[model samples]
Target chain A: MSNLIKLNGHTASVAEDEWLLVSLPASEAEERKQAGKVVLFKLTGENTVTNKQIANTVIPTTGKVIVPLSVFIARKAVLQARISKGEIGVWLSTHEVLEHLIKSQPDLNGLPMMAIHVERFADGRIFSLGTLLRTRYGYQNELRAFGDVLRDQLYFLKRSGFTSFQIRADRSAEDALASLNDFSVPYQGAVDEPQPVFQRYNRAV
Target chain B: MYKYDEIDQTIVDERVAQYRDQTRRFLAGELTEDEFRPLRLQNGLYIQRYAPMLRIAVPYGMLSSKQLHKLGDIASKYDKGYGHFSTRQNLQLNWPTVEDSPDILAELATVEMHAIQTSGNCIRNITTDQFAGVAPDEIIDPRAIAEILRQWSTFHPEFALLPRKFKIAVSGTKHDRAVVQAHDIGMEFYTDAQGKMAIRVWVGGGLGRTPILGSVIREHLEWQHALTYCEAIIRVYNLHGRRDNIYKARVKILVKALGIDEFKKQVEAEWAHLKGAPNTITETELTRVSQHFETMPYETLPRHDAGFDTTLVSNPAFAAWVKRCVHPHKMAGYRAVTLSLKPHGKAPGDASSKQMWAVADLAEQYSFAELRVSHEQNLILADVKLADLFALWEKARANGLATPNIGLLTDIICCPGGDFCSLANAKSIPIAEAIQMQFDNLDYLHDIGDIEINISGCMNGCGHHSVGHIGILGVDKDSSEWYQVSIGGKQGNDASLGTVIGPSFAAEEMPRVIQKLIDVYIAERMPEEHFIDTVRRLGIAPFKANVYTKEGAAA
Candidate 1:
């Protein structure tokens, strides 16, 4: 089980096996794991990290570390090149991962990716980031973001880009599972690809 | 006096609504301070030392009397009843709360004005000679070109986000009073033999950490291609200019980094792609903009004023006022009178509500209801007749506007330094006041003659300290305020940057330092040489030695 803490308002989660990690894309996580440095990132609780910790330079680029968002804006080219080569590991925030691909694609050919929801707080930028990444940038990967992610945001986030989530350890898995049935239809284009909104209906038929 | 057409009106109204929304979001906490910082800056709102300062663009230093009255009303209602005219030909209100800005902007919009792109990392208000259309030597009104750029660049999709702020100045007069050499892009308006006016464009001149004079890139570009050329330059700069270091982000640095030739080539390539496109200006649009000023009725009268003679004979003070405050007009009977806001010891460009009303009244009564704010920190009634000179001077003197120090040593161009500005190193207003008190003697100043003592609070050069005949820059050393003095900088016609004289001086010691330099000029000058001409003749070595010498041999 992971513990979550709100940091700079973004819900951040920490796992016992991890030294310190903010859920980022494959590239960011790869960079961190490769760096293998003891990382300290801001979070709402003991386990979760927010988008604010996306590019923070708490420790030098020794090995696994969390970076700040500003770092990505500055070193997009270099970071993109590294990500393309698959030499680094990254944890993508719910939405940030998609913007990167849409804005800059160093290796769009076939790159494995994953997403994380930092917290269950009131802030929704990460969810928007997720939806935009999936719907706008067309990222089809394991999307997980649900701390306090209400059924609506979860459904939207799922339809948009996210596909997987870590629910509250205390809550019943059945109740949590039951809330996921709030939405009837996937509206239109999503993280998967540019397909018709009624493609799910087509699948059902 | 470029009137707003449908497009111009549309852009301004759209900008006002945009700023209103930004303000609402900022007030409602929907936008964070970091997110709203650039948005407010794009609307020309600065959180200054005391309060929020709103800088309203007075495009090319031109304002209609109605516009001036609107500024006065905004200052009175929303602010502390006064406005400071900035060196950029803009008006700044220093005491407005965050909430009041939306209303103030909305008010400004009614007059076809909004503070868009004035303080942001985008193209700033395109400034031209204050005497643009009225100046005798102008080929055509540079305001024509300025208005074209105004329309084309306002909320320009691509240029809205640039690496750094860009400033373009145009000079139509032979004498470059517009400080063309110190702008990011300086264009001189000239006519070819076939009588078609064109722009002689120079790029990459600025004064901040690294002061540079622009090198000419395009000698003769047609007026229609002016906006496109400017867009090309800005686009190239936006993509290539450095963002890592704030100091290196200005286009001047980019020009320096790339070298002028390569920069010009890049700009030429960019220009090639952009020119003759959909954005090319139309002659009909130019005609529409030019119509705003084309039809001012002029009554041909004799050159001399008999009343001016009688007043000169009767009042020596009036004659002295004429000598200093008045200038020869392009029209025979008319004279351009400067309403000096810099009294014996006051802030350089500040005018109270009363003073503003007085100038408005005088403009209406004497000068065709038009006024000009000169780059020299004074207001000009550009078309006043010589016959009404005495009445105007008397009215101005009564209102404390007739300082009789136009272009003299005391007519110092100063910026609001540490007292108000957030980016100042030390207080510049006090420094100017101190110098003004030291040089109170009119005859002494007249003897010194035609000297520009410009002071900047910091290195931003808002005070135009670089081009002053005697420039003073405020620097802090060990917590004490000190000034760096420079000699021999001139702006008009032949522009040269001033050379610093050795070490800096304590704030109190600056006046003596200036006196010493003047003493050297007085001793070395041939018959009737001014400070700058003497510096030209004798070189800076003598002035440097005399200024920095242990003993001036006389004190």
Candidate 2:
């Protein structure tokens, strides 16, 4: 198993990942074998075609699978029975709004896992999205921030409310894990520490 | 003069260590140029025409004598023997090697100074009125709030990689000396109905290729919401600012595209969640930051120093210099002095190492050991006593700092254009020098008084030409250096952009073209009216007709 995974503030092997991502780039998926459960990202490329396919996709209930919200909403009846059994998880791209999923499935907040894709390391849309998922939507499960996850961005991602980071296949998890403590001190309120340094100064006094 | 506490000092020190490692990895080929570009830029290192230019942040333009001495030391040791003060109230060293920049930052850290966020897409140094505390028409001092912003924007996690660079300026008082509307997020401080400090927020105003004035979104936001409101704005900007085109990436374009109302709605929506969150300003921290800017050890002096007045009367040059360079201080018997950087032949704002050290010594001796770098690129001694003004003038003249033409046409605000900048389409320093030479007659310049001639290398607007009374923009025409002239721009409560006269002019004709414009102004201007006022009264039509003769700019 590949040892390029960082979960719960510790470096881990790929075997420890609960769900294998289905629609990762060929290079990333080929580098590691999937854990038995997989998050199917079938509608992944060429936006219009993928989106249309998602609209007409047949939800596969073969074993356990995490569904993209787009796929889940279009084919909710196919896996509606499985969600209560704690079998269905929801996945979202950082840019995808979660309000629709919450509207479609009231129990979406109680799902065991939610994964968000970061399109690029430099793109910070996921930071706000992850915060909203946790704070606004009350998502209290495995919050995964995957894709383009790298060393320099680890601390910010962790503070921005991602519980696990799937290191981009070519990067080392050991190096990325060390960056989580890049800043031990705080200045402003963030997802992980809501009390800015000013409040901390108050409590200290 | 907000001194860095232990926490502040530690963070800057750690940043120095972090940047040093990043630089090491880039040099070792572990990182590509693209990967290292943003990294170095966040630390204020830019690749310029000849070598690496490291921009050092002077937060709110406040500098102590010790800090100025350290800057002089760094300029001498790391680069050449000179440094350039930019229009943003920061210092730019134009010749440091990439390998030597880490050491320069490390040394800067010793003086509670760093180049962090000076040039990156992140929020830059927070600027305010250089005369914030000492100006005669002052409200509350903005140092505390500016310091708060300086800390909050430093090493911010989410906004670090925004689509374009962001600038924030706090206009401390009723007078818009900070040029509020020319910044990305400009704020003005005022007292509320409840006697609490409040701020007026202006989003999306900037001076790049597309110069646009800002609109007020929140006219009565309490000062406590400065952080939360700013956070909301940046968050909204971060998520939606267009990254497709580099030029359309500034918040100004975003605000323009969304329309000010819609943009304000989005920011307000985002702020609803962050409004009273833990990031809101508190009185405890305010008190802490305020103490650093508390009244200095000022001695009570007589209303007038008779000896100084006698000296001022006896020396006509001293009298003229006092009239121009000396500004009234809110503190009795004290004055604020501007040491002009726009002398006749020198590149405006370029100070040699010796000049830097001499100014630092003057700051130590005359101005409460504090100096300010104005956005106009001049150094300020903000707390000199009137009794000492004559002695200070003598020393300043000896050091080549007292030019006695503060508001005159010769006092030009110019960028290090084609001479030092790679992005410049044409040379701006030579244009400035030629104009200064042509207008070398101080008597004539004073007669035509209070003109702002701002020159920029290109549309990046580093020299803030868009708001100058007379704006000169360097443009490339058929691979040759040409200049475009504009008039009627002004920076005050009624700030407005300039209008281009006609066509572009060749380099050699710049001085003569400026001379012709001045001649028209002299012939037609109302008595004692400023150039901007005259331009506003007569409009650009007359100036255009007079400037573009058959053999002049039209040629």
Candidate 3:
């Protein structure tokens, strides 16, 4: 679990994150897909690893787990039983192909959690990706923005359909929480405020 | 002027508070310089070579008398007693402290002005023709739409951190006075086949290290789709514009790399989802905005005033001012007049607080209490009555605002280059001054007829050197300052980048080299042919040959 997560605009210590995200074993996943074999990824009660950097994966009999969307799609049969109970969540990186993911199988709509990765602080691709997922595709779940995220961007991150923020290490979660209300009014249309200023009030008057 | 309503007021007021806190954190050492740089830049505060330079937004060049007065107060109170009007329609205070910026922005908010999103990678101030509303040839008043664009771009969250700065210019008339062809996005208003107003959009135009004219992407887009379609374009660029190289980060590079056709395809695909969505412009909103730009109170006057005719015949200076400075208006009795910031021997666009106050008074007395900051680095009284021309001319002369060199060579557009900006390769202001001193003769300047001389400090083209008929670029030659001259660059509907003539010149030699170029045009030009027309008739070869002759080249 991460140190802190600002969930629903309330900053709290991350005592536990229901499911831990597991990165795909790239070469093995590709090889197993080529061989038409299912690869089961295990969620271990890890040590000596940051919550996001867990590496051990085989089958240690799973607890709740979140895998990359591709990993879950390849092993759908094994993951299907847990997904119905909202135990297996799917995660996607900002680097993933958006056009492919929007129309991906295993429907992101039913997931209990979908986390979008901000690989770099300046990479704004995830903002649009987050917007489309909530506004166009109508993804309604715990939408978390993690990895390389900071306090300065949390205000708009919340506006762009992000419900929870995993502020990057050692910085303030309370400060990030306060930054959410920096602007009491925003001019544009976003997930949080679907009605733009024009529709909300006769501004030009 | 578009006055701020409650929402507009709240946004700026909130912006002030937010910036105040950010400044406090920064000064307390909570925020590092790297982290605080972009935040400060977004508020139009740049840490220049000498001090913090704050650029105050003068939305599309329109300013009321009250706003002008407030700016004067701000200049004198927070900075040195002077400010410079930029090539883009904004004012730059060159001597403000980083600590005093918050108080400056707060003062601006009182006058319904703000510095939000004026700099940094976000969308910059939307510029149009300075004579937007009053131009006789205008098909539409671009201000209303420019205002809409301003609000849409201001504080836009997703776009606040773009790969590079983006600028947009709108032209409502056939003439491209706004220099639309040199911006990131240029829009022209026209009527479509359906008899509704539409926009002709140009993409990939910019003038930094690469000076490229915009290519037309969409020929006929309904005006209602402007904002949403713009969102689609910027969003695509935001996601796909190359971030690896700082030089290649502008939307122009992305548009060029993708090709206009491929880029248009992507933008159209994105716009399909956003078109007619919540961000679409509404008729009610447009109408409400348009009301703010409606015609000012004008009395019924004849096409020609007899008394004004007498004054013109007697006072040749006033007539010369009218010929070069006064512009035709849509209204019968009104004419738009240009107040030359380029007085004969002064720094091109520098105006003291005294001049600002004087202009504000003139704007109230003779021009309906409104003034416009022309992109050519001058002021405009857009609604001066014909009968008041003589009185206004006399007063403007007294205030150092009346120089009859509007379209002539002396009216140079220059950047605050090495003198102030951190990125400038060499000083630009001295080069402009040297040229101004050489051509100090008003008789020779007016005799030469309409020509534009634009100078840039570096390759940034902040002074729009690329589009000037005679462009001057300050370049560094082994830690020494040298200048490169180009010929035939033009702005307007037929905008073209100038071609560099030959080798660079020493600082003092710039004026003499320019003289050589002008001598060639004078010798070769046909009767009444302007410098640009002469250049087009003959190419850069003739001008290059004139400057690089044996003894001339040695000098």
What DockQ do you compute for every candidate structure?
0.03, 0.25, 0.29
Give the C-alpha interface root-mean-square deviation per candidate.
Answer: 17.5, 7.9, 8.5
- Return the lDDT, model 1, position B238: 62
Q: Is candidate 1 or candidate 3 better by lDDT?
A: 3
Q: After superposition, how far is residue B134 of candidate 3 from its true place, in Å?
A: 0.7
TM-score of each: 0.75, 0.93, 0.93
lDDT of each: 0.71, 0.83, 0.84
DockQ of 3: 0.29
Docking quality tier of model 1: incorrect
Residue-level lDDT of model 3, residues B113-232, one tens digit each, is: 999878888899999998888888898788999998998888776676787899999998978788787888999997777778899999889997899999998998888888888888
Q: Summarize candidate 2's per-residue lDDT along A1-205 as a digit string, tens digits.
A: 4534545444433435556453422222222123432322221222222455575444454545677777777776877677777677777775566667788876646677777877666767777777777766777777777777776776677777777778888767765666676666767777778777778765221
lDDT by residue (tens digit), candidate 1, A122-169: 233454455444533455543445454432233334444555545555
Per-residue alpha-carbon lDDT of model 1 for B138-188, expressed as tens digits?
A: 667777668667655555434544667889998888788788888899988
- Candidate 3: chain B TM-score equals 0.99
Model 2, residue A63: C-alpha shift (Å): 6.4
Give the runs in model 3 whose Cα sits over 4 Å from its true position: A1-3, A7-16, A23-61, A65-82, A90-93, B552-555
Model 3 chain A poorest 10 in a row by lDDT: A40-49
Can you give the lDDT of residue B50 in candidate 2? 81
